[model samples]
Target: MNIIEKHLAKAADLEKVSVGEDIRCKVRLVVAHDVTGPMAVEQFAKIKIEEVFDPQRVVMVIDHIYPASTVQARNMHWILKDFTKRYGTILYEHGQGVVHQIISENHAQNYGDIIIGADSHTCTAGGYGVIGIGVGSTEVAAAMATGTIDLEVPEVVEVNLTGSFKPFVTAKDLVLTLIGRFGTDGLTDKAILFTGPGVRGLSKDERMTVSNMGIEMGAMISFFADEDKDEGVAQTVAIELSEIIPVVACPYSPANIKPVQEVAGTEVTQVVAGSCTNGRLSDMKAIAEVLRGKHIHPDVNMIVIPASARVYEEMEKHDYCKVIRDAGAVLLNPGCGPCFGAHQGLAADRDVVVSTTNRNFPGRMGSREAKIYLASPVTAAKAAVHGRFVDPREPSGGGEN
Candidate 1:
C-alpha cells in the first residue's frame, strides 16, 4: 500500500481497505486558513464543541486576505485570532505565506502523517510523503472535534517519471503537461502516487508543485512515494521529462494547455511568479536565472512573491530579491497575491496575465474578460521581460542561460 492507504488503514484500525471502501480515519492535523477558517469555526460552534480534540494538531493560517483587504476581512482575522488563542491552536499570521506552502515547509513534515485542510490546495503537503487531504469546512470542523474524518478509499494511480529535466524545464512544466494531456477532470476520484527513478531526482519544491496541482486534474489527492518505498504493484503510467517544455495552460482552463511557442507574441498585461504552486526558493532562482540582467518590459507589471517569510528572508539574504528587482520585477511580501482574486495583482478587461499560480478558470484571478495562462516561474518571468507569451527557451528575453 502507498503511504496514504497505509495511514488510512492504520488510523481506522483496519488490516486493509479495498479500493472503494469508506473508512473513518484519524486526522493528525486539522488545517484551515482565513478564507475557510471562519466557516469552519462556525461549524465547530454548531457542534457546541468548546475545545478541539488536539489543539496542537489544529493549524489556523491567516493568509488569503492577509494584510486585510476589506473591513470584513479584518473582522475575519480577529475571529481566527480569538479561536486560535481559545483553543491553543497554531496560528500563522498574514504575510507568512500561503497555508499549503507554510505547512509543507514548516509544520507538516512527518512522514505518513495525515494532514487535512479546509482549502483544496492543502494536498500540496503530500509532497513530503504525508497524506494531505483537502476537505470541506464541515468535515474540517468534524475532524477538529472528533479527531477523525471519513473518506472513500480512492483508486491509486502510480505515475512513473523516468527522465531528468532539461535546462529551463521545471516541475511546473511536467504538471502542466499532465493536466493538458488528461484534461481537467481526468483523475477524478483517484489518488496519484508518483514513483520511479525520475521522481527522486526532483527537489522538494519541485515535488510540491506536482502535488499542489493534482487538483487541477480533479484528483482526490496526490503525493510522492518515499525515497525507500517498496510497493508491489498497481495501476500506473509513465512520463518522461525530456518530452516537456515550458508550456502554459491557456485562458479559462488548466486543461487547455498549449505550447508556449504557439501562444508566443500574444500580448500580456502582467506576469506573476509566485503562489503555492511555484513560489519556492528554487522557483525564484529559476526565474532569476532567466532574468539575470534583463529588465522586464515597461508595459508589463511583474510580481514575485516568496512562498513564506523565511523564503523571503532567504531570497533577500542571497540577493535573489535584488536580482529580481534589478530585472524590473516587483517582489511583494510573502503572501498569496492575486492567485485567487484576493489582491496585489488584479486584472482589468481584456487583460492577459502569465502566472505561475495553479488553476486558470475563467474569472479566477480577476475580470471575466481578463485571461490567465498558467506556466512555470521562468516561463512567466520570460514573458514578463518580453511582454508577451514566449518560451523561456527562446531568445526574446535578454540573453539565454
Candidate 2:
C-alpha cells in the first residue's frame, strides 16, 4: 500500500486497538452542535442506550443558537444542554468558542484515529492527520452506542499546489479555484490530499479552510501533509508554530490562478470577509492590515463576521474589530448564518457576492440568481473598499492614491 492506504489502514485499526497500544485507535472523538445534538439524543434514546461509550470523548457546543435565532432553535439548545448534562459530556458554551475553531486549537485530534461529527465540515480535522467525516444523527447515535461507525474507504487524489500565492490570495481562493476548475463535482467521493510546498506553507487554520470545503467538491475529505510519515501512527501531528501564515482563498479556479497583479479588472457587487472558512483572528488581522486607513466603497456592501465569540473577543481585545468597523464593514455574529443563506448577508437575484465562506453553489448565499465568488479575506477586504475586485498588491483608493 502507498502512503494514503497506510494511513487508512491505521485509521481502520484504531477501532480494535488496545487502549495501551502505542497506537490509540479504539478511542474516538464525537462532536455535535445544538442543531444536531437534539436529534442525536432522540435517536440514542430510541436505541434504549442509557449512556455513551464515554462522556469525556464527546464534545457538545452551543454556538448555533447562542443568542437564539428562533424559538425552535432555542428549544433545541435547551434539549442539548439537558442531554449533555445528563451524560456528563464535555459542553462548550458560547464563550468557550465555536466547535470548529476550538477543535483545531484544543489539540484534541490524534493522528491515524477516526473523528466523527454531525457537521459536514467535521472533515476539517483532516488537517491534523485524522480520518474525520460527518454523519447523520442516526449514525452519530450508533457510533455513540457501539463506539464505531462504518465507512467506505475512499480513493485519494493528490492536489499539488505549486508556487507561492501572491499577497491577498488565500487558501480560500485556492479551494475556490479548485471548485471552478473541477466544477464542484469533479472529485466526487474522493479523498483530496493537498501536497506540494505550497500546501506545507499554509497555517492550520488555512488548512482547515481547505479541508473544510472538501465537501463542496463532493470529496469525502481533504487532508494535508502525511502525519504518519512525521510521527508515530498513534501520535499527533506537530504543527510548526513559526511557519504559520495567514491565507485566504480567492474567487478564481485553479486553472485561473493569477498573480494579484493580474486581477485588476475584475468587478464585484459585494465583499464578505468572514465565515467558518476565514473568520479567525489571523484572517481578520490580515484584512485589517490591508484595509487599515481605507474605507469600504459606497457601492459595495461589506460584511465581516467572526468565526466565534472567542474570536470576536480576541479581535476586539487587539483592536482589529475597531479597525474593521472603522473601515465601514458591517460585523455579524459567529454562526453558519450567511454561509448557508439561513440569514445574514443575504443577496438578491443576479447580485454578485465575493465571500470567504465555503461553497459557492447556486443559491448558496441567497437567491439562485446571485453569483458567489470565493476569495481570501484580504481580497474580500480590498474588493469591499473599492467596489470591485482589485488585486491587493495594487495601491488602495480605487487603484492609485
lDDT winner: 1
- lDDT of each residue in 1-401, candidate 2, tens digit only: 43445565575674333212243224378888877888998998999868899888888777655667678878988888888779888777654555677676674666656778888888887776766777777878877887776666566666655556555456666666665556567777667776655666678777887788787777776777652232122222222232223233333332233444455556677877776678888898887786688888788888887887778888889888888888888877776557777666788985778787776666777888787776677777777877776666556523332
Model 2, backbone clash pairs (residues 3+ apart or across chains), number: 14
Q: Which ten residues in a row have the lowest lDDT in candidate 1?
A: 226-235
- TM-score of model 2 (CA atoms): 0.82
Q: Model 1 clash pairs?
A: none
198-262 in candidate 1: lDDT tens per residue? 98799889999999999888888888886433363357788887887778999899999888888
TM-score of each: 0.96, 0.82
Q: Residue 299 of candidate 2: its Cα lDDT?
A: 82
Per-residue lDDT for 43 in model 1? Answer: 90
Point out where model 2 deviates above 4 Å. 14-27, 227-269, 396-401
